[model samples]
Target: MAVSTRTSSIGGHQREPSGTLRLSVPTSYGHKRVLPLLPAFRARYPRVEIDVHVSNRSVDFAAEGFDVAIRILPPSDSSLVVRKLEDAAFVVVAAPGYLRRAGTPQTIADLQQHECIQFLRPASGRPLPWYLHEDGREQEIVTAGSYCVSDDVTGCITLLRHGAGLLQTLRFMVEDELRDGTLVKVMSHCAGSARPVSLLYPHRRALPLRVRVFIDFIVEKSTAWRRAKL
Candidate 1:
């Protein structure tokens, strides 16, 4: 039997892009979106080694040595290069059981009657306002509820999925549930608000080949993911 062996070089001229890529991403986004795409990225750039740090807090690029970072919100550091990857769309959703028991909310004002789950901001410990895009204008609704989750957004999602209450969350996080009828979308008229997800890296004269390809890869994939959802 004859087997073929592939070399890392093409005709002994160009070497395959190879190096360790240190990445930091939020826990929920990392688990749901970024981690799933890694197998394909690895298959394409087999020689590249990826060291991923999953956390919700900001990291110091120089201190942490992270080559790239994915952020759902804008990074405060002005020194690092920032590139907007995609808008993480948000939707207000509830488990069908919850909707059935609590009654579905039909208008932005109707949310007042429903048990809206709140996600508290880590920096300020204040509940994040629900951003609703209605009538071609964006409005921030200060929502209050008996239940609130902090630090990790996934906790809010868990409570929502179990029929605890309603939640406004990234569309990608609840896509499967929305499709499977486990969860149902409410307030369709005001569902277009989105959070910009950006990529961060240190400013350098020339980015390493491995980092360059990864940036391109993620941007491409994110575009496709957004289009599919649309």
Candidate 2:
């Protein structure tokens, strides 16, 4: 569902929101995207204390006492309200050195000829398939390589930087490297597939002021982020 981007006003005799906000988010996203925005959010909502929990596992909002969560995939539970934060685009990239040695791949079929780094799923302990858009549809392509990263997806990026192999990763993760020409994108024709990151919270008729403000803050920030990236 669409989240309203309206922010809470502190002016004109309105009560300033003050409380602890328990937020749960994925590790990578928490570090790269969310954490950096906290300082500004704090500046605006000075009295609101933020308690962040970074993990990949699904949280029990009621049992765990979490007020809000950010997830890459939508939850199955119907009781929780889901609002999309942003669509994270994944790109196929490799260091210039690695591409020079392996030869740049021009097509999706060409990826098989190169060493494609495999990112293992934390829950299943299996390699996560790469999703790419092709001919108006998304295709799941299972890739294999000499290197496998388990638990932490960022490990693949470390290997990628040292000319280890080709990697398909979230574009935001390698934005700096790509800008500096340290890494180069390949198979651009198949690169538009994106996964939606969403904000989740349990359904409640009346939410606390802190939670409501945090949700509005996140929605406002993410909308700007999407615009800036575009």
Per-model clash counts, in order, read: 0, 0
Q: Pull out the clashing pairs in model 1.
A: none
Residue 121 in model 1: shift from native, Å? 1.0
Where does the lowest 10-residue lDDT sum fall in candidate 2? 3-12
Candidate whose TM-score is highest: 2
Predictions in order: lDDT: 0.85, 0.85
Q: Write the per-residue lDDT of candidate 1 for residues 1-230, one digit (tens) a residue.
A: 43112223446576666889999999879988899999899898899999999888899888878899999978888998898878888888999999879898888888888888988888899998999976789988887788988888899889999999989888889988888888988887897577889999999996877888888889888887778662
- Give candidate 2's TM-score: 0.88
Q: TM per model?
A: 0.86, 0.88
In the order shown, what is each candidate's alpha-carbon RMSD? 4.9, 3.5
Cα lDDT tens digits, model 2, 75-159, are: 8999989999888898999999998898998877888899999988889999989887767898888887999988677788889
Q: Model 2: which residue pairs collide?
A: none
